[model samples]
Target: MNHESQKTTIANTVQLGSDLSVNRLGYGAMRLTGQPGNFGRYADWTAGKQLLRRAIELGINFIDTAESYGPGYNEELIASALYPYPDDLVIATKGGVLKTAPDNIRTDGSPNSLRRSCEASLKRLKVDRIGLYQLHRPDPNVPFVESIGMLAELQREGKIRHIGLSNVTIAQIEAARQIVDISSVQNRLNLAERNGEDILDYCTQHNIAFIPYSPLGAHPLKRGAPLANAEGILTEIAARQDVKPSQIALSWMLHRAPNIILIPGTTTISHLEENIAAASITLTADDIKLLNEAQVF
Candidate 1:
């Protein structure tokens, strides 16, 4: 097993208000589900429990999940594994997308649905207050403020500690903040995709943590791209550092912004450990330059 035994420290940690202090190196629990055709197929109940426990032992203090993950199975798994959860860990989950049969997905931003989903998530995660509750996506049928207004109400009632948004444009981010505090933004970003660079830059400037989902590019990456496509410079860096391309890619994101948090997912302990180990590896200035250069095109 090629383990990332490097021992480097992050430059700084982001303060998400008074409720939590995130170390910036976090885990994404999306892979903890039995999603069809997912690389990290949600493992058996026993395997899921072990993986969640191992994540904590590796010093990962932050976790990201969604109510749509497993449609509820993922939260129940977290409860089964980490119930009576640690006080220091920050668990972030999102709502707003309604998943039905035959790969059908829809949005519901009605105040009643938002309230009900938040309450149901509480029951599944087995927690009283969500560390970071995010509105998964904007609902075209409903006004953005209307959806966020409901979230704000939840925070006021002691049901949530912080608020976040996902898969939204900068304009949407600004709009949502008008109604509630926006602590973080989760967006699709990876070596092969740089569409969210501007949002990332905006977050860095404002001290908001930018959580990059799919830090590993989605399948069918450009030919010879690293980390996902396995063809990009990430592969080259991995070879040089004796680490996995995925680790190199993750390290790049961590280095890209002081306030960035990575939530790479994995089902097996080996992959999980490898993902966690990226935190300890520090890239050189030359490494950064090389990766950025390849970002062109």
Candidate 2:
């Protein structure tokens, strides 16, 4: 289908790599698992399962998860929701971070450990080949090249269709680019976090899909309160555009770069719909400048 035609298709997918194509709007399954390690704390498993189903129903073909989340709970939930999976859906999962405890997340880039994690992720995801497998973090203990080389090996073996990196530096991204084709880069970025700007710009220049995790801050936004202090720019511009502050925040990211993709996760269906709808709002150049100059982060 043509690009414009595909845009209207919720199941419409876009190719980010030689073998990876997923819907523009996607879901993140981290919240499906319970706090600490169980599945009982957040919401009903049946309800969580329905959330996944609803996301697909809304045309979110890109679903992101990590092995470190619930250490394994998110992947299993994804399998339950998507097994006998849709042909157009893309399942992206991360490795490299090991959860010592629910609150204590550590990065381990040992080649052997990465292989083992990929094997396990494959089993839990119920797919012979992952659509996009990412290295969750760069391991200080292992040479970066060695870690990326292993992912390249997996791609060649048909175990992973594409490779991506998360929480990496520009130098690290450049280094990985040399070892293998990097299709996507996941990083923590929000209206409150601009530390990843350089990498985000680099990805734009290189034609890589930049996926922003936590595009909305983890903090609770007060009801009817502005995103910034009174008279702050976020509120002013959002008011001018007739959009919510969160929508403005997301629209700023999309305005920053066209290659950017957002996977804002929430257990609440209303919030999920709001996040997806942000893509429809357009930010003018002036709107982007105000957001960039706000200096909140």
RMSD of 2: 5.2
Ten-residue segment with the worst summed lDDT in candidate 2?
Answer: 220-229
The candidate that wins on TM-score is 1
For residues 1-297, write the lDDT of model 2, one tens digit per residue.
443332221223445886566656677777777753422234477888889998988888899998887778789888887789989888899999898665566789988889999999999998899989999999999999999999999899899988999989999999999889999999888777888888989988998888988777654221221232334788788787686777778667766676777787778888778778877876665666667789654
Off by over 4 Å in 1: 1-9, 37-43, 219-229, 295-297
lDDT of each: 0.80, 0.79
| Candidate whose lDDT is highest | 1
Could you list the CA RMSD of all candidates, in the order they appear?
4.7, 5.2
Per-prediction TM-score to the true structure, in the order listed = 0.90, 0.87
Write one digit per residue (lDDT tens) for candidate 1, span 231-271. Answer: 55777778888998888888888888888888887767897
As a whole number from 0 to 100, the lDDT of residue 99 in candidate 2 is 81
User: How many clashing residue pairs appear in each of the predictions shown?
Assistant: 6, 1
